[model samples]
Target: MTNRADLHTLTGAYATDSLDDAERAQFEEHIGQCPACAQEVRELSATAARLGLAAAVVPRPALKEQVLRSIATVRQEAPRTEPGPPGGTVPRAPLRRASRWALAACLAAATAFGATAVWQHREAGDARDQAREVQQRTEELASLLAAPDARTRTAKLAGGARATVVVSEGRDRAAFLATGMAEPPRGKVYQLWFNDKGTMRSAGLMDPERTTSALVMKGRVGEATGMGVTVEPAGGSPEPTTKPVALLDFPA
Candidate 1:
C-alpha cells in the first residue's frame, strides 16, 4: 500500500497531464482507494482552475488600439509643426535651430524604425531557412533512423493542419523530433506510436505545440514488421485513431 500523502504529490502532474504511463498507473492505483487523495487532487486541480480563470478573465485593458492611435498621432505630427505667423518676420536663428532639431528627429525615427524592420526581416528569413534545412536534412536522415549507423533526424510541422517528422538515427537508438505542430485541441494530441504486426504500440503523447521530440524508448530493427506514424487524440488513443501518413517499409 502507498501513502496518501505521496499520492497527493502526484496530483499536480496528474492534473497537468504530464505523467508517463507507469506513473499514471501508479497514481491511479493510489487515488482509487484513497478518498483523501482524490479530494486532494480535486482541491489542487481547483487551484489550477483558478489560475487558468485568472489568466483568461484578465482585462485586455483596452490598450492596443489606444497605443496604435498614439503611435499614429506621433507619425502624423511629424509633418505638422508650430511655425511663426505667416505674415510676420520670423527670427532666423530660432528657425535654423528648429530646422536642425526637426531634421535630427526625422533621422532618429528613421534609424529606430528602419533598424527594427530590418531586424524583423532577418529573423523571419532565418526561421524560413531553418525550416527548410530541417525538412531537407530530415528527409535525408529519415531513411537512416533505424539503421544501425544512423545518427539523428528532425522535422518541423506547420499548423495542426500539416505535418513534418525528423528522425535522427544511431546504431542503438533514434530521436524523433516533432516541431511547428500547432497546439492540440483541448484534449487531444498527435501521438507517437510504433506498429508491431497489426497491433500498434505506444511511443508517447506529443507536445502541446507539436514541437515535441520523442526518443524511441526501445531498440528495434527498422526493417521489422513495419514502422508507421499516426495522429491520435491528445492523451493518445489505446490504438491509432487514423491511418498512417508514413511507412518505413523499404525495398518495396
Candidate 2:
C-alpha cells in the first residue's frame, strides 16, 4: 500500500493508466482518504486525456503485435508493499518517485508529437496553395497561346539582336521573346516598356546573362499602342532612360 505522501507521486502514472494493478489499487485506497491527492489525480487524468486526443493517430497493422511482444519481454515491477492487517503498508518512496518522473516524460513526448503534427499540416497546406497558383498561371498562359487571333511580330535591334512580340486578337494579353541581345553595358539591364498612346509603363526586366529570354507581360495589353526595349540601370527606371534598341508598333 502506498502512503498518503507517496500517493501524490503515483497520480501521474495513475492518470496515464501506466500503473500496475497493485499500484493502482493502493493509490485508489490512499486517494479515498486524501482529498488533495484525489483532486490532483483528477486534474492529471483530464490533461492526459486531452493530450491523447490531440496526438491520436492510426497505428500500423503490425503495431499491436509489436506492442504485445514488447510487453511480454519486459519485467513488471513487484508490488511496492503488501497491505497490513488493518491499515495500509508503507510505500517504496524511490519507486513512487521514479514513476512520477516517467509519467512526466511520457506527457512531454505527446506534447512534442502534437506540435510537430500541427507544423507539418500547415506546411502541407502552404504547398497545396502554391501548387494551385502555379496551375492557374499555366492555364491562363495556355489560353493566351491558343487564341485564334494570336499573332507574332519581330523587330531587329541595333546590335543584331531580335525582339519578337506575340499578341492576342483582343490585345488583352501579350508575350515577348528576345534573342541574341548583346549583353548590356556594365551597371545596366534591358527594360521592357508598353506605350499606351503617349503614356509609358514599365513591363519588366530582361535577364542579362541569357542570350534568349521570354516574358509574359501582365496587366491590360490592349491599352498599349506600342512596345519598346531600352538599356537602363540594373534595377530599371520608372521611365525610359535611354533610346530604345528595338520597338514594335501595334496596328490601330
Candidate 3:
C-alpha cells in the first residue's frame, strides 16, 4: 500500500488479533516482505505475550461480586452513530475501543525499547573510549620503559619511603614509581609535579588506594630540573598544596 504509516499502525491490532479479516490479510502480506515491520511486530507480540501471561491470575471470589456491583451502578453509554445503509451491521464500538487501547500500549512499549537501546548504545561508546585511552597509556609506558637512554634517580622521603623516577631526556618523557609510602590521610591524594627551570606544572595524580604504583608522567620534559610528589585534596589540585614529600633532581 502507498500509505505505509496506515499499514504500520495495523501491527499492534494484528498482534492482539483485534483487526478485521480484510485488514488482517493485508498486513499479513505486507509483513512477509517488510523486515522492519516484521521485526516491530515480533517485539510487540513478545511484549503482548508477556503481559498476557502476567494477567492470568485467578481472581478472588469477592472480585467478581465487586465488579458486578460497580457495573450495576454505572450508566450504560450509547455508541456513536455513523452514516451507513439501512439494514447494514454497524462496527462494534467495544472492539474499536479495545484496538485503540492495545495500540496505545504497544506504542508505549516501543518507546521504552527505543530509550533503552539508545542508553545501551551510548554506554557502549563510552566503554570503547575508555578502552582506547587505556591502550594509548599502555603503549606510551612501554615505549618509555624500552628507551635505551632511560636513566633513574631515587629520593628518600620523610617517613623512610622511597620514590624512583625514570627519565629519557632524548624522548622527553618520564615515569614515576613510589614504594613503602603510607596512604594519604582521608580526603587527600598524592599528586606528581615536574619543575622545568623555575616553572612548576602538574604531571598526574597517584592512585589513592595503591601503596606502591608506577605512572608514566605527562607533559614534555624540556629543561625539567626535578620531579616531586605532594599531598593534596582528593581529586588533586592545580597547584601543589604542600611541600613535596620527596623531590629528585634530574642529572645535568
Best lDDT goes to which candidate? 3
Q: Could you tell me every candidate's TM-score relative to the true structure?
A: 0.31, 0.44, 0.47
Give the higher-lDDT candidate: 1 or 2: 2
Candidate 2 regions exceeding 4 Å error are 1-142
User: How many Å off is the CA of 136 in candidate 1?
Assistant: 28
TM-score (C-alpha, index-matched) for candidate 3: 0.47
Off by over 4 Å in 1: 1-148, 151-172, 212-214, 217-226, 245-252
Better of 1 and 3 by TM-score: 3
Q: Higher-TM-score candidate among 2 and 3? A: 3
Query: By lDDT, highest first, what's the ranking?
Result: 3, 2, 1
Worst 10 residues of 2 by lDDT: 111-120
**Considering every candidate listed, which one attains the maximal TM-score?**
3
Ranking the candidates on TM-score from highest down gives 3, 2, 1
Model 2 scores a C-alpha lDDT of: 0.64
lDDT of each: 0.45, 0.64, 0.65
